[model samples]
Target: MDALDASVPAISPSRPFRASVVTFRALVGSGFRRYATYRQATVAGTFTNIVFGFLRCYVLLAVAAGTAGAMAGGYDARQLATFVWVGQGLLNVVGIWGWADLSERIRTGDIVADLVRPVSPVTAYLAADLGRGAHALLTRVAPPVLVGALFFPMATPSRWQTVPLFAASVLLAVVGSFGCRYLVNATAYWLADARGPLAFWTLGSGVLAGLYFPLRLLPDWLAVTLWVATPLPGLLQTPLDVLIERDPPALQAGLVALQAVWAVIMLALAGWVQRRAERKLVVQGG
Candidate 1:
């Protein structure tokens, strides 16, 4: 028998590309279009975000009020309101939960096709996530923020620079969040079902990421540890704090830098794990 063509890379039994900018953009556009097609879901989700925004706002304000309107957890009433509403908006932007498509594909053995594709799964999925984030920014984010701004004393960024800084942080959060979800879904390779990990991630991510409250409210040692050891704060707290100008310029810059670092690290880890999973497929004749 002819030796397997030396030029062709060996196909791993169970597997899974760097997509270029043009390809990446197309992937993103496709993702955006897919989510956009769900008009009713978009509306329902937006309404839900708005409702939660109000609920969280009132609870946080009450906390501030009980402290005689003094700054609690470094947040005055106005800043606290901004945190709640903006955080509600960011829920869709970062998409802290609700990703299971990859796991389903793996369980169905459909991911083998993905392995044959030219595009890297990481880049493709991330591009699509970017597109999804773009859609959320336009539809889900603006509404709740506008509603809160209209009715509440929300804090505005003290410096114009904070606006752009916050935007950068938000973008990094999206990338980092995708990396996290990708890893969680990859568990399907070994577990046959990713539900357990997905459920646990959903519950823990919200609190750890500061969706329900500010990280600063936690004890100093705990908050600092979370900030340094995990990407959770970058998912919401960093961006919102930057938006409200809660930190000095230097610290704000440091926060965004930290987010960038986490984004890179998480993506790299995902890529490495994907490669190892592919190797397992080869060894198992998957």
Candidate 2:
């Protein structure tokens, strides 16, 4: 499994997790070293994001210019710039694309190998994903932000709590994202392939998560609906909003709270879904 399997579970004894703390640490290190070998691809992706960042920033600034009082969707010019640039930085950190390992394994029946392992596939994959997110933050998130800062005015957090809050939000985002992706990939266990679901996921996730544009640009009712009802917004929008201090301090904390809730829900659902699939397979054995 190429680390993106999101299918590998850590382990559990009486709970959803079973892997020892030391084994989980080794798995995380293995995941980190696995992706670190892709040096050139990381550079290429960074360059692509930078190019898109320029285009996105200019277009958003134009929209802001035409808005009443230059408040483009509850954001000032500086915040919009920060939103674009920092968003570009976080794009990979939350990993919105290029994860098919789990589905591919299921389709090939290699998941049978995973099933017999000592650890739970879900927890194992989550630890690996954390390693991947850490690598992304170290290598993929900086260049575009630096490039954006050189060319545009990016918002800096005015609150002392913003930095810590933003960090917490990001950790939740990665955890939530892994669960969401795992669910999408797990569809292969039933559907023979995950392409159909993955297509729908790829189609909606970026837009709904506020990657191409802020959800706030939508009508308040719709934006709030997405925020409260779906996990999409928490993946990217919550952290970016926290980092830019878009909401008041209390509201900022509230958003992170929401992210935490969604992360827990997604993980619970993933564990449930995987258990269901396993139960079916075992019952069919004659």
Candidate 3:
């Protein structure tokens, strides 16, 4: 009896943790391998980024010249050029594509399997998304950084002291951006038509996140409103400010704090919605 009992399966409470770790590793590995196979797309993307970087620089220079402005948002013409170049390069690293959502899963009933997994849905999704970002960083960010460096004098921290702070800020920006997207995706739990909401969020993110232009150049009231209400400015604009070494300590700290707060709030909201979604899951059509 003792020998037979020793052969029986053992169920541990930590099974979920072990499963999550394995899932994360497999997801990241597959993402890396998949990205490596897309060599042509990566090369083309790098060239396209370089062209756009130069074009944006030319446009900004023209604007500065016409206005006879010393700077807008604490950037000279050359500095602004560098900012645009870096921003475009980092765009892919930041997962500009909004792909994480349970809509497709729900539509196809694929989420049925996900629901059975030992890992939390949000954590599983985050692991997969981080894997994708890792691939993009290597394939997309690196080449553009090289090309932009050759063409423009990109901004660097004035002192080594800022490097740690900059790194911390970028990390927080990643969390903030991911959190906002996760919240947007979670809305599919309630609305049958989430496409419109997703589109609206994307457009709003572009404007408020300062992806198209520096937030500082925006109208004062509009900028203030966005900074307070959305996570956009913290993601791209704050990183740019850190890179340019122009932002005051107080402002940078405030932005980082805002990013942390948003990340926590969005993550909490996503968890709540996900739990509610489990009970609401309905198979409507084949």
Candidate 4:
């Protein structure tokens, strides 16, 4: 009996991972609930995006109208209108700005509590952010799209595969965007105040991710370079382009594939940075 008791494993090898997944899922739910509390903010944000959608759509439509082929940046009038509406809808979902949670915690010295939690801070925050993004899709993304469809000729998906592909792209975009924001927020781990890096990330992500206009308007080489070299384009531009069918079905798949790769890379980078910060904190605490 004593030998049998000694030989038995207290916890299986997969137990920790399983437990982590459970915790992550629960945290995701918690995140959803947390964001759901911001009812007023959600409505205001959706309204703001709708307002901007109109302004941007009008300007882009005018540009396309004046161009030689009734196209600007390879987008026809309807396509450009769709782009504007979708971009506006995604503005909150993809979280281009207004994320400073980590920085605020670090500044307040409250982040130490996160370290003591069972789940890794990265996983916990990411799960929560996924929930927040999910909430945004419902509360923020839909309204502007409905409003746009009522007012403008939004382009329909050209291919059956486009719907699924765009859905995948948006998921990847949300994850990749969270990773980017996570890293930007993690800067507070070292800097104590992450304003400079956060500001730069905020501004650059908006412009480079095709928030103001489609990236295809740039020179082909520059557009390709940005798409291949930076995660920023994958965060917003790839998803938007995929939705609007800027390229053929094969090319659209390729773009979403690229987004998956960046999503992996960004998450890996965030994890690495988190580990480094944890080790440093331990050393300091010791």
lDDT of 3 at 266: 69
Report the Cα lDDT for residue 192, model 4.
79
lDDT of each: 0.87, 0.89, 0.71, 0.87
Kindly list the per-residue Cα lDDT of model 1 for residues 46-146, writing each as its tens digit: 89999988899988888888885478798998899889888998999899988898888888887877888888788788888999999988888889999
Give each model's clash number.
4, 14, 1, 0
My TM-score estimates for the predictions, one after another, are 0.91, 0.91, 0.83, 0.92
Instruction: Kindly provide the TM-score of model 2 when superposed on the true structure, using C-alpha atoms.
Output: 0.91
The candidate, 2 or 4, that scores higher on lDDT is 2
lDDT at position 275, candidate 1:
85
- Can you list the residue pairs that collide in candidate 3? 209-232
Off by over 4 Å in 4: 1-18, 282-286
lDDT of 4 at 137: 85
The parts of candidate 1 lying over 4 Å away from their true place are 1-19, 282-286
In candidate 3, clashing pairs total 1
